[model samples]
Target: MQRLYARARRAWDRPLTAYYLVLGGSLLLTALGLVMVFSASQIEALQSGLPSTYFFQKQLVAAALGALLMLAASRMPVKLHRACAYPLLAASVFLLCLVQVPGIGHAVNGNQNWIQLGGPFQLQPSEFAKLGLVLWGADLLARKGEKRLLTQWKHMLVPLVPVAFMLLGLIMLGGDMGTAIILTAILFGLLWLLGAPTRLFATTLAVAATLGFLLIKSSPNRMARLGCLGATDPGPEDQCWQAVHGIYALASGGWFGSGLGASVEKWGQLPEPHTDFIFAVTGEELGLAGTLSVLALFAALGYAGIRVAGRTEDPFVRYAAGGVTTWITAQAVVNIGAVLGLLPIAGVPLPLFSYGGSALLPTMFAIGLLIAFARSDPAARAALDMRQPVFGRMRAGVRRKTMRRRAERPPSGER
Candidate 1:
């Protein structure tokens, strides 16, 4: 057992461990998401007079596209990522602005944050903005130097805070407080990675809390959601309906679950069985084991992301990994928290597990960015290079065999 443990330790210590960890976790989550989405959406799709596989087909297509994007990003050179930072940020800002164009932007569920891009297709700029912020912040800080940002608070806060707020304002204008909160998380996560002063963090936290209170108080729906705290049963018909159903779904599933595609809540009881509340459906259908596995995979992904950041010497890679890690993990926490009734419903989709094309695309790309960072580690690059097949190995083996045969001849005279 000790020998096996030592072997496992050695394997885990490899430079490529971070890369494999991220890949494995992301793929598992994506696959599981497909299964859950299909199961949860079956009844809804059929009720809409569409094929039973309508939502599943759409989700599968999105997943395929996302996988291609992820692969492209993963193979991209780190320098290329840095080079594209400004352009990507600029484009994201333009899209965010364009989303506010009257008649051009589309509204859904009180949030006018999406733009219709032809039939049955909509694009969410806020999702792209998350990626943009991470890249732009990392590039800016990496250029200024991580040490300067750490020592000088002014250097850290200057344009970053203002730009972040501007983005937040744009998102909030569209009534998407959820996306705004996530953007804030990315900004602060980057700041924290740079070792911002504790006082600064505290100040920011207080301000954010105050602002969040104001935002929540301004919306009746948000207030109702906040009121769901410590509720045994949903009060009004439309008040805590989603939250209550989510809990009911979870409670209905014991240890092994009711089996896949057998979730009672997804039939009609639970709203958004495949999106924001998908975790609850997962619990109902696959049980405690499914939910725990999802959490474990996310934890592994987070560890891999942090490991990549820590092992890298490049400031850009470090900051980017840190920001991406925080973005994915924070959003996951919010999504899961809402489903578990621990927090107000934030309408944020679970990373790699939700039924939204817009969310999945950028998230997969971000995971790819993490993979790129892991691959860029010098030791990891060397190890991967050594794995490539080489015809020279065959020639070297032949040369060694000849040399051994000659040596076995017992010298020039003895042969």
Candidate 2:
């Protein structure tokens, strides 16, 4: 057992481990999410007079586009990414502001945070705002750190906190408390990575908590969501209808589950089965084993992200990776916690596991950011360089064989 443990540690310490974990874990979660979305959404789509595969098809297309974006991001240099920070933030802020305009902005499920984009499609700028904040905030802190200005409390909180608040205020203006909470998490995450003083951190946390409490209290809907925590019975008007149904779906799947596409709750009982409560549907269809597997995949991805952040020499890489990790981790925890009745329903989709194109696209790009950082490590870069020739030789051999076969073969028309 000791030898086994030692071997595992050595393998984990390899230069390429973080890269492989991010790549493999993200792919698996996305693929599984596609499968679950197809399963969970069929009934809802059919009831809406659309094809059973409608949602799945849209998600598939988004995944394809996201893959291209991921590929492009992974190949970009650190300097290039840093250069893109301000532009991306500007675009995010612009789109987010656009969502507030009448006739242009749209609402879904009571959240006015979308812009209609022609037939059967919409844009959620808040999702991209999360990515923008990660990159922009990282760059901001990295610059300050280089100048040794972070030691002062004012410098630490000045522009970063204010910009984050501006974004949060915009998000909250659309009544998207869930997204605002996530943005707040990303801000604190950046500050934490910078090693802010304990008193400052605590004071900031208290202020955020007070504001959050006020926000939640002012909205009856938000209050109702909070009241549903650990609820065993659906409240008045079935206020906990979605929450209760989610629990029932999870409970019905004892160990292995009812099998994929066989969930009863998704047939109209549970709300947002393909978006918010998809984890419950996953439990109902794939069982506890499937749920645990999903959790493990997220854990692996989060761990790999932390490793990339911790092992990096560049302050930008460290802060950006840490911020991304915090965003995804916080969103996932809030989402999964709501499904399990451990916390209030925040209406945030699970990272990479929920069926929203807006959410998936930015997340995949963030995963690619981690991949880029992992590859930037000196040891990992060297390892990759050593393997390039092997791949090149394999490609060369394949081309030669293909050409030889072509020369020896008869024309297709003759055949």
Give the number of the best model, judged by lDDT. 2
Among all candidates shown, the one with the greatest TM-score: 2
- Per-structure clash totals for the candidates: 0, 0
Worst 10 residues of 1 by lDDT: 146-155
Q: Which residue runs does candidate 2 get wrong by more than 4 Å?
A: 400-415
| Model 1 Cα lDDT, one tens digit per residue, 111-168 | 9999999988899999999999999999999988945644678888878888898888
- Model 1 root-mean-square deviation: 7.0
Candidate 2 local lDDT, residue 266 = 94
State each model's C-alpha RMSD to the native: 7.0, 1.8
Q: What is the lDDT of residue 384 in candidate 2?
A: 99
Candidate 2 residue lDDT tens string, 220-313: 9999999999988898799999999999999999899999899999989999999999999999999999999999999998999999999999
Backbone clash pairs for candidate 1 read none
| Candidate 1 residue 103 C-alpha distance from true site, Å | 0.8
